[model samples]
Structures are given as C-alpha cells and as structure tokens.
Target: MAIQKEQIRTALAHVLHPEKKVDIIALNMIQDIIVQDKYVSFTLEMPIKNDPLTQELSQRCERAIHKFIDQDAIVDIQIGINVSQQRQTPAPEPMGSPLSGVQNIIAVASGKGGVGKSTVAVNIAAALARNGAKVGLMDADIYGPSIPTMFDLFERPNVTVQKKLIPLVKYGIKLVSMGFLVDVNQAMVWRGPMVTSAIKQFMNDVEWGELDFMILDMPPGTGDIQLTIVQSVPLSGAVIVSTPQNVALDDVRKGVSMFQKVNVPVLGIIENMAYFSPPDAPDKKYYIFGQEGASRLADELAVPVLGEIPLGQPIRESGDNGKPIVLDNESPAAASFLACSANMQQQLAIRAATMPKDLSISFTEKSPSAHT
Candidate 1:
C-alpha cells in the first residue's frame, strides 16, 4: 500500500489529547508529515517542555499509524515543545499580605513523616543563600517546628513600630518559626483554627521584606494542617520529598494530588536518602532503603526527579548542630543540595509559566539533573 500525507493526517486525526480533549489534527499538534517507502516520520508538537504526556501521546500516534494507516509502516516520532498560544492569567493572591515583595514562594512537603523534608528545605535555603540570592525560611510545621533547632535560633522576634514581627536573620537568610515563640520543652497544644491563625500570622504579621525566594518548610502529611497552610498562603509551587521506598512513595502521591487539586504546579521531586555511601568506599553505593523507588514514581507521575541525595552522617550532624550540611561547600552533600535547588528552579523556568522569568535565573552553573 502506498502511504500519502493525507492518509497520515487522517490516521493522526484519531489521536486525542487527554487534557485538551481535542484531536491532534484540530489542535495543530502534528506537523512536517513526510512519507517515503512506507517509512513515516513526523514531529509531535507538545504544549510544554517535559510534558508528562509526551511519551504516551507519541506512542498513541505510532499505534494509530500502524493500526489505521498501514500495518507495516515504519513510524518515527520526534517531540518539540511549543509555547502556549494563549498565556494563562496569573491566579489572584490574597490582598494586603506581606508576601507581595517576594519573587517566588515554594513549598517543600511530603506525604508522610520522617522523610527528612525539613532537612531538605533548610539546606535548599542555605544553597540559595550561598549563591547570593535573598532567601527566607519559614517553619510552616506549626506543631513540629524544626527551623529553630536546625538554625539554632532562640531569640524572641522583635516587633516593628507597625506591630509587625521582625524575622530573624542568620547566615544571610531571614527566618521565622513557631519554635522560637514556644518553650523548647513544651508541645504545641492547639486546635485547627489556632494552627491556621499562627500560619496566617507568619504570612501577614511577620516583616519578611523583599526576598528573592521564600521557601516554606511544610509539615509532613496531607491532612487538615497541610490544607489550611496551602489555603492561607500564595504558594508559587511545591517540591515533593521522599525516600527511595515504596511505603513513602505511596504518600508522595497524596501530597502531589493535594497541591494539584488546589491549582499549584508541582515543580519536581527530590529523592532523599536514596542510598548510602561510605567515606572509605566513595565509589560503592548501598541501596539501604530500596532502589530507585522515587525515580519510578516520578516517571509514572511524569514529573522530573530533581535530585538523589545519599543518606550520610554529615546531613544528620549538620541538622543536630544547628547548621545545614550545605554550609560546608566543600562536601559532596553540599554539592547535591545545591544541584537539587538549581534543578528545581529550572522547572520553575520551564513548567511554571505563571512565575516571573527572573525566578528561574541560576546563580550557579546549570544543574546536571535539569537536562531531563
């Protein structure tokens, strides 16, 4: 059977975009259709770079050609990301909030606890600071505040004449946390409204003046506290943190869903404690928590895996000593944290069209993971 351009178009017309619910031909997604000796090749125009649907849609087009056009035709599909024809309007934010001056506000969250989400949040903030970006770290985990002990801040926040609370500065990053307000020995015994009130105060009552990035260290779990915080603040995007374990990856789905339901773009995922490496044998890796669990999940979700941080003693020591691991700049763990932070911003550049372009500007060299 002789293949024609019109016949190829007819076959592709049967392929529909899952999200837009429109056939590729009507959407103008198929182009450069060339037919030679039954070898069919064409460019598949995707709506955005790194779209999760890129693979599935490309496969569908290939199958459509084989099943509908010619069973023996050879299919070669290439993907090209297209700038949206119509730019989406930015979502309206809460009026009169102090976050107006912040360039980008992102959340570091997890589906379940004990995934080292706070450690990742604190170190990412430190990496940004090391690159000379003005950064702010907020302990959104009202019940289990870790920023105070992580940063070793114990001084009570001072009030401005306007009655706004002044955020404390350490290591060139502004920080605020419930840990600073309550006694070190006491547990935060409060209701949902009280927790929401404290978070609102952190956003509205605190004086976090002009920052390049405001990183929220969100509490673990996808529950009422998490929902309340997301509703209370204008988050630019979110980063899901999980260990390379199936149990943790299960919760990661819930966390990602919560953000997606609220219209927040999930920038990427960070696979924490992916493996363990010994100082004596740097080349050897031990898969202590399972192998490539988060990577598989990211592939299924169609999001980028920003980094894979190895489990190590330095990370724990730095947290216990009130200094994040990235402060040591000479260590391998610092390099990993810095790279993860950079790749995350790269997603903010490519996936998040609603963010300011300046938010994607990299202070350091490009990240290795951004290639994905």
Candidate 2:
C-alpha cells in the first residue's frame, strides 16, 4: 500500500521537541506534508532562522518515521524558517541583474521533444553571433543535454579566480552544458530538487560576462527546470518552437499559457519542420507534417510567425559536425534560422520601445505571487 499523509503525520508526531517538551505537531513546526508511494517529504518549519535545534529535530523526525512508520520510507525533510521576517525584508538595491552582464536571456522552449528545439536554439545563437552580438548558449536541458554534442564541446568549463565557471567558447559563442560536468555515458538519475539545484548553479555560478544575448536551450516541457528558470532569472522573453502539426501545436499552447501565467512574454513561434524540400529540386516543398499549422496558431494567438525551418540533411550534418548551419552562407536551412533571429530581434526591439519606463524587469524578484 502507498504511504498516507496521516500515517506519516502520526509518526512525526512521536518526535518531541527537546527544548519545548512538546511534539512538533503541537508546536506546529511541520507544514507542507507530502506523501507518495514509498516517498515522503515535508517542510520542517521553524519560527526563527538557523535555529540550533533544526538539525536535531530533523534527524529525530527521520528516526521516528523509520521506527514508527515504514522502515523503508524515503523521507526528505527540508528546513523553511523565518517566513515572516524574510517576507518583510526590503528588496536589495538594484543588484544590477540576476545574470549581471547578460543583456537578454531568451529561452528557446518547446512543449514536447523531437521537434528540433535545440537545433533552432544553437543556430539562432550562431546567427546572433554572426551578426556580431556577444552570445552565450546555455544547455539547460539537464536530463538530455545535447549542446556538448551539438557544438562539439567535450571539455569541462574552466573555473575563474573568483570560483565562477568559465563557459567554453565555441565559434565565438560561449557555451555550458550539464553533459560536460558528468560522465557523458552515464544517465542522469536526478529528482526535482537535484535538477533545480544544478540549474540554479548554472545560472548563478557561471562567468557569463557582458553578453548581448544568453540563449537558453530549455528542456522540452513546462516542468521544474522551466519553472526554476522563469522564477530565478529575469527572462527578456521566450520563443516557442513547434512542428507544423496539431499534436505539437497542442503542447505549444500549454507552453504559451505557462509563460503567460508567469508574466514572461512569449516572443513568437518558429515553425520548425514546417516543410521538407528535395535537395535535387531545391524548390519543391512537401508538407509532410501539414502546412503552416504553427503559423495559423500564431495568427490565432496574435503573435508573430518568426520563421519556418524546413527539414534538411545539411542542418542535421552541421549539428553533427559541431557547427551550426547558420555558419554556411549558402545553406537555405541556415537562411531560415537567420531570418528567425532577425524577427526575434525585431520583436525584442518592439518590446523595448513599448516598455513602461517605471517598469522594473525584476518583476519576478520574490515572485509574481509575492507582489499580489
């Protein structure tokens, strides 16, 4: 049988506070109790920050749960104290920006995988760099990092004198990937907290100085990593990539809605795999996935159709060769990514022009919720 909240609560109730001579339940030190199959997690809420008894009580709770409840129960007790005071702390003076030197942080995201999201991201980064904009591409897809393979970057990022990670430079674009830090052959077996922590380290600890744009190749979906990015960084905007098919467009809608809910502006949509053209004909376009489905959806949403990328062999080969197709001036596929980059730049320009002067980009500081 799966673990129940009440059963775990009953076990935690057995642990008494040594200083207060009362159970944690009576002291109301527990909040946000969660239970799953054999996994249990709860917040060990305390009244003050860094209480000396915090660690002691946490261990006791673990022991009590094992002794009184399921011996095999996996427990994750997180400390969350000083709620009232932390909430009331004044916002620190303009710390510049969370990602200090990066001018624009754009996440290239898709609702589902296999829609060629990363391809679009890498090429977009390359195109932006080709135009002489200082660009950085962060492979935020922790579960299935492809930037290392896509950019042919095999070495780990060097650490600076200040202990910040020095992102490897590739073809003039700075790059970072989870693939570089771990054994490449080993599969990442990580949970939500672990994934979030690793991503936070990528954003906070990397030496990304004075970038014109930081392109984040987000994991396919609106999950923990996406949420953490939106909450942690002041994203200038997001570009939704989708195939020209209803199934992919359906998730694209969800992705759009998720960004809307978080106040991150959806820049526009790039219809990848919008069509396939024969190398021999060079002009014959086949609507294998359906025609302009993403563009129609973009029309419905009143957003711009950035550009349509056709499926091509050279594009794939370029990724395999550790070079973006955009570097090839003759490849038609590269033309598509460059056009998309231009449209994206135009959208960013529009957003900048209409910005409220009083508008603080740090709108996501504590959170959109904290403001409410």
Candidate 3:
C-alpha cells in the first residue's frame, strides 16, 4: 500500500518529549505536514529553542516517517520554536486626558484575595521611587483599599485651587486610595457602577503630575469592576501575583486570560510567599506551599518569573507599620523586592524600545485628548 499521512502521524505519536513526558503529537508540536509523490515534508514547533533534545526529536521524526514511506522517498523535517500569543479582543474606548503625562501605567492583579497583591504593588512602587523614577500608587481596590495603611497615611487628599484632587505623597511616591476619602471602619457597599465610577474619578479628578510610572493596586477577581477600570485606562502592561500553590496558580491563569482578552501585555508573574527560612538557619529552605508552582505557570504562559519573595515576619510588621519592607534596607524582603523592581524596569525598558513611540503609553482606538 502507498504511504498515508495518518500512518506516519501514528508512528510519530510514539515520540515523546523527555521532560514533559507527553507525545509530540499530543503536545501539538507538529504542524504544516505535507505529502507529495515520493516526498514528505513537515514542521516541528518546539517550545524551546536550541534545546539539547532537538537533535534527538528530529532523528526520531525522520525515523518514524521512514517506517511508513518508501525507502527512496525524501522526508524533510523543519524544526522551529513557537512563541505563545495572548488572546485578542477589541480594544477599549479611548481614555480621556487624565494620564497624559504618565509614561507607563502597570496594574498589579491577582485572581483571588489574600495573595499579597497589594503588598507587591506597594513595594514595587517604593522601589521604583527609590531608584529616582517618578512613581504614583493608586489603590484601585475600592472595596478594600490598603494603600492608606500600607503607607501609614490618614490625611485626606486636598482639593487644589483649580478644583482638582491632589494625591497624597509618601515614601516619595504619589498615592490615592478610598481609605483617604471614607472612614476606615465603614464598608464600601457600592454596586458595580458606583465602584467603576469611583475608579474613573480617581484617574481623572486626581492631579497626578508628571509620573514616570503609575502602579495600580487592582482588586482581586475578574469581575465587571475590574473590566471597567482596565477599559477606562490605557494600561501599559499588567503583572500577576500569586503564591506558590496550585490553587493560587489556577486563579493566576484566569487573571492572565483577562488581561490577554483586553489586549494588555502581561509583563510577568511574581511569586509571593514562595518559601520560608528561619533567620538562624538561612541556608535551609522550606516550601510551605508547592515548590515552584508560579515558576512553572510562568513557563507555561511564556512569561518571566520576576522574583520569588520569601515569607517572613518583617514583611508583615512593615505592612502593619505603614512602612513597606522595600524601604527597610536591613530586611531580606527588601532585597527581593529590589530585584523584582529591577527586573520590571528592564522589561519596561525593552518594551518601550521595541514599541512605537505613540503606541507605548496608550492602547485605545481613539486619539488621546489634550490634558484638561
């Protein structure tokens, strides 16, 4: 019988990836298979480039084709790397002239609550400010604004002579939060529209003057309010925060999907509460959650794992004291946050260099309006 494509594919299915432990066909690595008279050509989309197993996989595929085809037939196998692309959707409406001067606006998000999303946002902003970048931190978590407590600032934002609300300053970073507008004890029992409106007002009414970067402490979950805020602003990118646990990583995938749907590039993932190490025995490491969960997720998503922050008492104390651990040079958490900040800055710089100047700041369809 003449050679058939299905027979060749069945043979190739026996070839498995050594690390992923799955057949190459099941992994969807095989693409663009073509069969002509006495000739066969196919492409292998590898996840990693220059992998040590590339040669082995190539030989295996050639052998598989030889088994089904005539002895004199030519079999051509092309090996190439495949990069994953984010899901695409229609871009959001153009944001008005609220954040014209801000070079980049980054949202720090999580799929669920209590993943240290706000803490990561605070420390990253503080680290950038320390590095001499003009930074602003806006608490977009209207229901649970923690920036006020994180920065230990209770003073209400002042209305300027021009009728604009001025963002409070702490740790050399401009800040705004619902905690500053309402009593800390009161619950924000507002609906979706109200919450979205408040976030819009925070973006437009607040006079955030000349910021190099704005770190938005986003609320947890992928709800309407989250969609509204993201749609209302021209976010440069987003960073997802999650613990080193399967549960947290599952939610993280949803968060990443939401940003991808909105056409916002995911900067990377931050693994918080990654591990624990006693001060007396710093060399010893303990994985309280699963080991390398976030790192594996990042790899799957084709994004970088910015940093793995260890769980420590000093981090909790600094948060409660309204002083982020990044400001405390003596703490180990400070070093971790600094490293994360550096990685984030490098990513931002690379993005800026590659993107067209006009496309760098905003991702809306309409032309940006003049600053009002």
TM-score leader: 1
**lDDT value, residue 173 of candidate 2:** 97
Residue 42, candidate 2: C-alpha displacement in angstroms: 45
TM-scores of all candidate predictions against the true structure = 0.72, 0.70, 0.71
> Candidate 3: deviation at residue 77, Å?
24
RMSD (CA, Å), candidate 1 to true, equals: 11.3
Per-residue lDDT tens digits of candidate 3, residues 297-336? 8989988888989998989888999998998888788989
Residue pairs in clash, model 3: none
lDDT of 2 at 239: 94
Model 1 agreement with the true structure over 1-372: per-residue lDDT tens digits:
689999999999899878667688766677778899889988776666666887788888988998998888888776655653221212433555687668778899999998999999999999999999999999998889999889988899999999999999999999999888887345467778888898899988999877888999998899988987986777778899998878899999999999876657788899999888899997788999888788888989887899989899989989989998999967888889999999988887665532321121112222222211
Query: Candidates sorted by TM-score, descending order?
Result: 1, 3, 2
Any runs in candidate 2 off by more than 4 Å, and if so which? 1-98, 184-187, 357-372
Indicate the residue-level lDDT of 215 in model 3.
94
Better of 2 and 3 by TM-score: 3
Clashing pairs in 2: none
Clashes (candidate 2): 0
